[model samples]
Target chain A: MASSDILLSVRDLRIAFHGVEAVRGVSFDVRPREVLALVGESGAGKSLTARALLGMAPRGATVNGEIRLDGSPDLAAARGRRISLVPQDALSALSPVHPVGDQLAAAVRSVHRVSRREARARAVAALDRVGIPDAARRARAHPHEYSGGMRQRAVIAMATLNEPDLVVADEPTTALDAERREQVLRVLSEQREAVGAALLLVTHDLDVVRDHADRVLVMYAGRTSELGPTHTVLGQPRAPYTAGLLASLPQDGPRRRRLPTLPGTPPAPGELPPGCAFAPRCPLATDHCRSEEPETRELDGRLVACHHPDRIPDDTATLFEEEQPA
Target chain B: MTHLLDVRDLVVHYGTVTAVDGVSLTLEPGETLALDGPSGCGKSTTALAVLQLRRPDAGEVRFEGVELTSLTERELRPLRPRMQPVFQDPYGSLNPRHRIRDAVAEPLKVQGRWTEADGPTRVAELLDRVGLAPSYGARRPHELSGGQCQRAGIARALASDPRLLVLDEPVSALDPSVRAGVLNLLADLQDDLGLGYLFICHDRAVVRHFADRVVEMRDGRLVT
Candidate 1:
């Protein structure tokens, strides 16, 4: 793809906390109005990677990389106007003191030179657009008064109120159950589409990635494990870690006594193994894998960071056994 | 044999609002019975009533052929240890100030089952059984990962040697990889100990995979 075709480009993004690198040399791009999912377990640096895009890395953290917005490289000036965030905690994104609608109107007035009445009307319409029933009345209520699902929707509305080119949502639906999760995700996707914004969605839910994301970037430890189209990557995974994660998922099928789990936990930052960060737990790890860190290489129409991508078994379900006595 | 747990006409009310209405269920030993539903649908309320943590407004909770609703506080004291609850938020469920070892040993010490000679050994055994390392017992709840903290919570529940475990969204708060490990541990524990599980979960995939039978709840009533 051409450089101009990308909405946002990140090159060798590195985030470090007190000299210990957590997100090490990760790189990817957000295409124009596309949903790119950043997926991994806790401590995998997916959240930090997303935060770095908005120049919102944690206090005292050192971030070094190239984050360019349409070849401009000025994220701070373009944060709310061109790239907005829908954080995991909806309450934190909203003010408990102000009515939800007023907060959204304030967000609008900050970016655009609009009258208060016009902004308030736009706020209520935005709320209504996200399926918040009685948007006018509910907009007058504080965020604490809104139900959990409604509070989440209000945040979604607030994020897209400015109609940014990119929306970075970090685990927006993690706290919700099945029904509420679907509702919130639908509203988020719909609002993003209505605003014509690409999404940098950071979540641990593979089902959400499969259903919503156009492309997926699977991170392990702090590096890219795989990056490809959602169906191709999830259906025929080229990375061992990705396959192990998929195999562990409980599907709607005949129940099994045990799930195929990765043997060890993800290594803590600054404590990674000699070669691959996932080598200790990877079933396909060989001596070569243990000695040399594999760079991101193109294979099977996707990017996989593994020396033996083709050696991944056809049936990844049997990759790792629990090794228990019956 | 009597059913391990039998709840009949269970009703819980928060002031004027009825949370769980006329819910009935039965679980046999070594079986997992899931109460599946959306949020605010009274799944946790029913579990609390079964555990007698929240006395139902009206119901009959018969555990091991004994009607618990008729029991007084003193009468219910002994039965409390037999039915334990594993909550959703692993860190919130455990004390932040207490060491993981102390948390696990609390139930043993409370029930007058602890001895100076074997208490520490028993704590070590419980931690090992739940896939936690011995060194982890020295740390507080915040120091451990979510999955490890949940295992610590499970070890604490197992310290009571309960006949029934009221697992309320035990794995939902965990990551998928970690959730699978916890679920596997629960399955192994139930099989080896012949314990019954009153599993309350909102994830349908997890309910279908983990439970022997599932009852769907909506508006405080069973849909099926």
Candidate 2:
């Protein structure tokens, strides 16, 4: 991808608190109108990385490295105008006091010099676009009156009201159930396409990443594990951690007595191992893997950070075949 | 023989709204019966009714040939330990201020079964069975990871020596990697103890994989 094609460029970005790094040297590019997913287990710093894009890293945390948006490093000024954030909790993102439409109108007026009537009109239209039924009348009610799914749609409408170049959704559908999760994702994608904005989706659900993401950036202990096109990476993972994660997922085929679990837990931030952070849990870990940190390099048509990417089999199921119940 | 859990015509109403209407289910001993549904479908409500935490408006919840809905709170007290609940949010299930050791031992203590000599040993055993190390018992809920905290919650549930476990979205809040470990632990425990599981979850994939038989619920009623 050319520099001109890149909507957002993050290079060697690091986020830390009290001198302990949590997001360490991660790099990625979000192309125009593309869905780039950041996937990992808890404490992977995927959320922190997503937050850093909008300059919303928690207070007292230090962020270092380059975060250029269309050749400009001024993310602070670009917030809400060029970039928007749809947080995990829709209820928290919206205010309980104001009417749903009023809050969205306020958001519209926050960046643009539109009149109150125009802002309100755009808010209702935005609500309609996200498939909130009876959006006109429903907009007059408080957020407390709307259902959970409706509140989520209202939050998405609020995020895209300004028609930003990029929208960062951090676990947007995690709180919802299976049916609602798919519905919200559908509405989000529809709204994104309508606005012509790229999406930075941060989620731990691999199935969601598989279905929606154009490209995936797998993170582990605040470092990139694998980065590539969704099908290519998920179908044939080049990294051991990615393979283990994909294999562990409950497939839609015949039911098995046991799932292929990756043994042990992800190491917590600040308690990371010396070398490759995933070495402790990875089945392919070697003495070299334990001693030397693997740099993110192109391998098998994708970026993988592992010493033995070649050792990982195309069929991840083989790694756990012995553990499979006969 | 009577079923391990026999819930018939279960009806739970919140004011005018019916939360669970005429929901019926049965589970044999050592069987896994899943109640699969979307949110607000009364899965949790049914579980609560089964455990007698929330009294159903109309129903017969027979556990081991005993109808629990008609039982007095005092009468139900002794049978409470025989059936336990493992909830969705692991962190919320365990008390934040209590140590894992104390949390697990509380059940024994509450039922007047705790002894100074054997209580600590029993708690440690429970923790070990749940794949938690002995040292983890010293930590509070916040200090442990989500998966470990959930294990502590399971160990606490096990301390009661329950025959039936009501698992409501047990692994839904956990990451995929951690969820598999917990599911494996549940399977192993069921195999060893022959415990009946009333598994309530919204994830269809997990339900299909884990449950021997699954009943779908929608709008407070069972669907085909």
Candidate 3:
């Protein structure tokens, strides 16, 4: 992770809607050909962070951040060209009426000035690269006509068509079935190298995060809770939010009476409590945690925003039992 | 108890395309049968056919040993009360205009399970059973989160006192952290109610954890 190898660097990024901070002081970097995952529950600002990278933040939002794309120092100028976005909801991400091929060609032409025929040809190649079979014929089909998985691939093809230096895919595998999820994840991992672009995969899929992502950034209530290599983070999460999330996942072992859930829902952006927003829900929260926000600190090899970054002992059952839903 | 739901050689066609081809599955009381597959693999069409939302081109759907395929809509009304569906998109499936209380009680009222007094009480009880607070009964679908709306959807379906619940990707719309809660709730509900479930989902991991029997579908047919 050399500085120069980083394709996109986000420092002290803050996004707010109507004076409500949705993403507050989040920071991370996406390195070339690396797959980095941003994981969190809804309202954790993962989507907003990804949106900010593409300069596609919703209307009436105040954003202040230093986002360096390919060392260019500004994402606004690089978005849709050096940087690309593969949005959630493939059906809606694509134009329902337009042929998938034409939409992809439009994306290609957006970055590079090319003839319609050349762009269409490139679009077909891109679709084929993503493993959409019968690319030429399928590209001719409308978004509605293509299957759910195909629609996702077509969208992905459009994102990576220009071989952008950075790609931010928001919930790419969501709303898809197991096989299709695997297919989409495979396409993303493959395309990261083939296109030589860094991937900022924003998803809640822990399975994918563990298997596909090189590094992981865990968010909680509009803040960076943990940022580390996937193995280190998922294997031994230092942040209570990350640990609680891992603890809550239903495993293949035995079925529990109820899931080990983090108490209370994520705070709404505007209504977020003072101090650490997650203090109310954190099992390890202290008096200090309730009175003051925890500053991001360097733990062994990662950044952890927690008063107690010491790894919780692996009592397993008791650790899960301690955090009963409030 | 005998099989609560039984499907035989079910086939659904969309013109020239065979959406669900010769698929057969059965559900025993208190058992969860997960139909796991990718998109466009006919898992949904099979669920729809089994629920009689759509007619099958071939094969039979029998509920409690009675043939559902040949029954007319009017004739199917009584039997319909024994089978209810919890759909995929809670935001889309739950009526935006109706409050949770009304939505849940509507099913009971349709089935004549309540008089005036029992309806509200029953709605409250159903809401409680689905882990929703009684206060939530007053809120509309739009006021609730995705998980809350899904819980309301489940509460509505449970209002019919159905022995079989056809849950179509019920937790897929929910956030991952919320998904476990819903799944645990569904599993708990099955234990308490002795409900049979046709859990149609694409997540194999979920099926492995939740389903007693899993039938994987690929391209309109079962792989195993």
Candidate 4:
């Protein structure tokens, strides 16, 4: 898609909490009608970046750098109607006291001046769109009454009630089962198509992103390590950390040897190493990587921020080797 | 080999809601049986009932030929060490204020097997077995990453020397990459220790990889 078709553009976005930089200078774009995945481990600043985009960052947090949304609309200034968040925990996100329908209707009324009756009708329709079998009845049920999958659907319905231009879904399918996960993902995909909205899907599941996201961004230690088309980035990751992540997933069938694991844990924000934040865990880190930070450079239509942006030659072999045994 | 756990016709109810209906399963020694199903399909409830954490309205939960359901809380206190749970949210499951050593040592302490002299050594060994550095025992839960916390949870579960470990969505909260490591660790631990696992999860991929047999559930009933 062309640059004009982009719904959101982030450049050198930095966010810090109490002098601890949670999100370093990170840049990416979300195109209209596209699913862009922000893939990273926990504490990698993915959630923080998503929260900053929707102006829901924690109190006393400082956000810097450029964030441009479509039509000159300052996303930070926009209300929930323009930009909505589908939180990770569906159980906690929905209020236990109120009926799900009432909660959804409130979202619809927030954006448009609608009567209570009209909002309820719209809420039922939204639930129906998300494939809640008995949408009308489900609308009247409280959060506790609904199953985890149904609760997630309710959350999605509320998020899309205003037909927001952008939706930031953080680990939306984490708590769902396999079948329910597929259903929830399908609903998300359908919503993106029907509403023609850009989606910033922040998740740790590569399988979810591999099939759903058109573009992918890899984040580590609060910085964007790699960004490119989903297939290209996942299939042939240039960064060592990205390659390690891809190597670590269990194959579809059976395997013989032990699964590959990254060496160490991600550094805490306050204790991040001076040079490259991932140097400690990165297998290909050199003395230079521990002394100077790498800059993002374009290589084959993808942005990679590594001093050695070469693909791991043995990654595919190592992954496949374990699949075959004598 | 005798079954480590035998759950027959397990029926658990939450008020008027039947969370687990007539669920029957068995875990043999050194085998991992995965319970796969959609959310709210009684998988978790079944796990809880097996551990007697939830009172089953009907059914029998027998561990090593002993009926667990018939035991009162006080009577079942000692049985706790024989069966342990590795919860999904490792961060939440472990106490933030306690060091990893203390979290793992809690089970031993509760069982009165933990002495100050041997607790540290045992904790270090458990951490090493779970692929964590011995030094990690001194660090608190907040100091470790999600995957490490999960490993620590597994270490704690193993510390009890349990014959059966009920792992509830053990790796669900972890990243896909880190997930494999934990799965492999569980598989290795089971093989080495000859432990039986009631592996409850929603991910088909992980189930297929780690489970010796798969049981599917739907709406509080077993489909397969």
Candidate 5:
């Protein structure tokens, strides 16, 4: 892909807290009109990395990296106008005291210095675009008035009001169920199509990512495990951790017995041992894995970091299949 | 075969909202029944009525051939040990300040089954049975990880030795790697103890794997 087509690019991005690194040397790119998913469990440093991209890192975090947006050298200055955030928890993400219209209007004015009347009109149009019924009347209601799904739509509307080039959504559909999950994902995909914006989706739900994300980035213990197209990575995972995550989902086999699980817990900050962070729990870990950290290597249109990679036998259909008979 | 628990035409409401409307179900001994539905769909509300925690507005809850909806709290005490609940949030359901041993033994103490001679040993055994070290009983809930806290919750639920367990989204809050272990533990407990499970969840994938029979709910009513 051309450099101009890439909306956001990061090189050697690292976040440290009091001498301990939380996000270690992460690097990637998000192209225009593409959905790039960053998948990981708790303490995987996905959220921290996303927050740092928008100049909203956790308190006392030390971020060191080269983050460039298209032609702009300064990313922090063009945060709202060029890049925006769609937070995980929609209920508390929007302000409680003010009307949603005002919040949306404020977001619009943050990027473009439009008049209040024009901003309000644009806010209503944005809310209507996100499929909220009676956008004009609903915009007048407070955050508490809307349902869970409605609140998420309002958040999305505000984030995309200015048509930013890049939208960093951290677990956007986590709070919704299967039915609402589909609705929110449709809104997001449609919004992406309407406004030619790149999406950086950070989430733990592998099932959602398999269907929605165009590309996938697997993270483990603050390090990049695997990066490839969604189908390639899920069908034939090149990293051990990625395979473990895929295997953890209930497969479409003959029986729904015990699931294959990774043995140990995710390492916390400062708790990582010598060598690869995932070596403690990986089934294929060897002596070399325990002593030397692996580097990302390009292979088969993907980047993988591991001593031994795996390709599932029989080419499974998909992860999280609806039902398997007993 | 006689069912250990039965509910007929169960209807529950919260200020005319109708959280659960006309739900009927039964659980046979050693059987696993999963309830699948979205939020605000009355899966949780229906499960609550099964335990008689929320007395139904218009329905019948019979446990071991006795109706619970019509019984007083005092009259229901003797039959309470037959049904137990394992909540969703491990941190909130348990007392943070109290040790794991005390939390696991509280149910036994309530039923006047606590004996200094066997209480400690039974608590350790329960912890071990749930794949936790016996020494973990000395730690508080906050001191343990999400997986450990959930195991402690299971230990406490199993302390009552109930024939039926009502688990509400037991593993939703846990991480994926940790999720399978907990689910496996639940499966093992069900097999070993001949326990009946009323598994309530929003994810049908988990329900299909963990439960023997599936019940679907939507808009406060069961669908087909």
Candidate 6:
């Protein structure tokens, strides 16, 4: 992570809706050509933090702290041609009434001054880039006419039409099946390689992040709980919450009847407890964890927020094996 | 163990389009059967048909030895409590304006088994069982997270104490990290209560993890 190569930098960012802090002082940096994943449970503010980068926070939400895009003061003031988003729900994001080709053409024309015919040609090329089999025929179809996977490809096509510097994908593979998920991820990877754009992928899928992301950030209760290399954060998590999450996944080898779950639910916005937000559910919580919030500390090159960070039992194999009954 | 719900040659047609065609399956007590397929493959239609929300053009739905296809909507009203569904989208499934307590108690009320005196306590216990706080009973759908909403949906589905629960992509809308938690919760609930589950999803990984048996569907028909 060279400072010169950094494309996006978020520092002490906080978001509040109706006086309730949804994202509490989170910070991370995205390099120019690497994929950084923000992984967390629902209500962890991963999506909110992504939206904050584009100044797309919900109405009436108050944002504090700094967000610098390519060293710019405000992301909203940055050229629209530079930053783009691929939203989660492709069906809802795309207009159902219009032809898919027209939507892509609009995106093309919005970023570049081109004739309608030229924009259509660029749209077709973009669709082709995303591996939609019949790019020309599919371009003429409406959003509803395309399959769910095809519609998602079209959304990606639209997101990359302008060859933006940064692509923010929020749960891009939520409803997609295993095959379609692979296809979509492959397309994103190709786009990153060809265009040299930074990717900020916000998802709940640990497998996707582990495979595709260069770095991983674990968010809990609207804050960054841990950040490190994908393998370290996943394989040997330092934070108790991250370890609990890893324990809960059903991996390849075996299966357990019940995964070891972190007790208690996600804290509601504006109601988070003092000290560590995860302290209530963390098994390693002590008096220090309950009274004082731990600051981000560098341990083995990864950033972790915990008073007593220790090694979690390497029960991955055992837990997974237990999940499988004879 | 007796089969709690059985579907044979079930077919659902929307005009000429066959959403679910000739699907057959049987779920035993305390078993979790996963129905998996790509989008538009008719897994949802089969579940809807079992609930009698979609009338099948052909086939029989047997619940505890009783055939449901021949029953009219009026006759099926009582049985509705015996078989309830938990949908994927909790926000859409739940009435946004209704409090969690009211939403969870609605099924019991519809079955004419709920009274005002015990409704609150039952709802509280249900919320707690689903990993939500008892105070969450006062919150609306919009006030909770996607996982919490799904938990509420599960709690509501369990309110009537049904023998079978049709989980239609129940955890699909959740985050990957949260999904494992919910799936574990479902497994715990099933083991504790000895409930039968018809879990419908498109994710193979989830199906392999949560189900005792997996049934694959394609174009409204079972492929395997």
- What are the clash counts of all predictions, listed in order? 0, 0, 0, 0, 0, 5
**Top-DockQ structure, candidate number:** 2
Chain A (alone) TM-scores for all candidate structures: 0.98, 0.97, 0.94, 0.93, 0.93, 0.94
TM-score of chain B of each: 0.99, 0.99, 0.97, 0.97, 0.97, 0.97
Name the DockQ score for candidate 5: 0.69
What fraction of the true interface does each of the listed models get right, in terms of native contacts kept?
0.68, 0.63, 0.50, 0.68, 0.62, 0.47
The digit string of per-residue lDDT tens for model 6 on A1-326 reads: 46678888899999998888999999998988889999888789999999888778899999998988878776764545677888889999999999999999998888789999999999999999988888888889899998888888888888877888889999999878777888888888887677778899999888899899999999998888899999888878878878777766666666555655555677878778888998887767887888898888999779998887764556532322233434
Task: Return the TM-score for each candidate structure.
Answer: 0.98, 0.98, 0.93, 0.92, 0.94, 0.92
Q: Give the residue spans of candidate 2 off by over 4 A.
A: A321-326
DockQ of each: 0.76, 0.79, 0.51, 0.62, 0.69, 0.48
Any runs in candidate 1 off by more than 4 Å, and if so which?
Answer: A324-326
Clashing pairs in 3: none
Model 6 RMSD in Å is 3.0
Candidate 4 ranges beyond 4 A from true positions? A1-3, A71-73, A314-326, B13-18, B55-59, B70-75
Q: After superposition, how far is residue A6 of candidate 4 from its true place, in Å?
A: 2.6
Pairs that clash in candidate 1: none
lDDT tens digits by residue: candidate 6, B29-136:
899999988778898899999989888999999999889999988898878887889999999999999999899988878777777898778888889999888888
For A204-235, candidate 5 gives per-residue lDDT tens digits of: 88988988899999988888999989998887
Report the alpha-carbon TM-score of model 5 versus the true structure: 0.94
> Residue A276 of candidate 5: its Cα lDDT?
89
Better of 1 and 6 by TM-score: 1
lDDT of 5 by residue, B127-184 (tens): 9999888778999998788888999999999998888899998888787778888998
Which segments of candidate 3 are over 4 A away from where they belong? A1-3, A70-72, A254-259, A315-318, A322-326
Alpha carbon lDDT at A194, candidate 2: 85
The segments of candidate 6 whose C-alpha lies over 4 angstroms from its true place after superposition are: A74-79, A316-326, B116-125, B128-132
Better of 3 and 6 by DockQ: 3
Ranking by DockQ: 2, 1, 5, 4, 3, 6
- Write out the backbone clash pairs for model 2: none
